[model samples]
Target: MAFSPEKSNFRSPLKGPPSPSWNDLLLKNKKALNHVLFTMHLQSRSNKQTPSSSPSPQIRKSLDFTLPSLVSDPISLLSDQILLSILSKLPDSQRNCNSLVSKRWLNLQGRLVRSIKLLDWDFLVSGRLFVRFPNLIHVDLVNGSLISLGECGCF
Candidate 1:
């Protein structure tokens, strides 16, 4: 058989200088690349590390090498039931903060806060406790003996 490079199944890599298109792309996106690097550096500096939080699949796609806390968010990928379940573990203050993240989250947070703490029975009766917390299952009173509002209208 004759030595024929064209007939061979295998092909050698370019021995000549690399194409300038790659260089053009690099130059054009110099600022974007820097922004991506800086964003990644800040994210790395923070201690909270998770596969989703890392430069993983979703983040990479969203970042496209420029990802942040997501324009939509990967956590939204979770079912609301699971998301609410996860949110339920957070403290009241934390939950309150989380509620401000979005309307859907606010509704979930509201529904998950099944307990209410009141100064006394007066505030409980004065307020539409049931209407306020449709999912409320428990009430914590600060001072019980001194005064008691027998029955709230909302009940």
Candidate 2:
């Protein structure tokens, strides 16, 4: 009886118990393990991607690892409130610049801005304050040159 692997390279005419070759079993196990690992990777990725907002930069980096058309599910990314909080933490100049990154960002900017100060009102885009920060809870008007009972239209 040849029990060593090196001696079982050839088929024998005598057959007793059918023993599956080690190579064949290993190949099957390898494929199954690969599939299970891939499934685990996907599950873990989804769990980690649902963070408050750090994934913004991470996702951009992830896109470099995948094809442009193979993006992950957008809905599972993050909650709107968390994302808004993250945006609120950014500097005014940065947040305003990034507001044009996507439609989502544009909408988020409006809801995230809790307050703002207007100095030279005329220097701003007309109606831009109201349009961009419609949900702003508090706003300070500092244009000292124009202040009247009926002329505070910009405010």
Please list the Cα RMSD from the true structure of every candidate, rounded to 1 decimal place.
22.3, 24.8
Worst 10 residues of 2 by lDDT: 67-76
Residues 6-86, model 1: lDDT tens digits: 778664476555547534854577667557555645465455666555655565555554444442443554568977887
Model 2 error, position 37 (Å): 17
For 40-147, candidate 2 gives per-residue lDDT tens digits of 455656677756644467775664445324434432245578668777877899889978878888889887777877775663557777777778787777663456
TM-score of 1: 0.35
Task: Give candidate 1 misplaced runs (Cα > 4 Å).
Answer: 1-72, 117-132, 139-155
TM-score of each: 0.35, 0.35
In model 2, what is the error at residue 35, expressed in angstroms? 15
- Return the clash pairs for model 2, or none: none
lDDT by candidate, in order shown: 0.65, 0.65
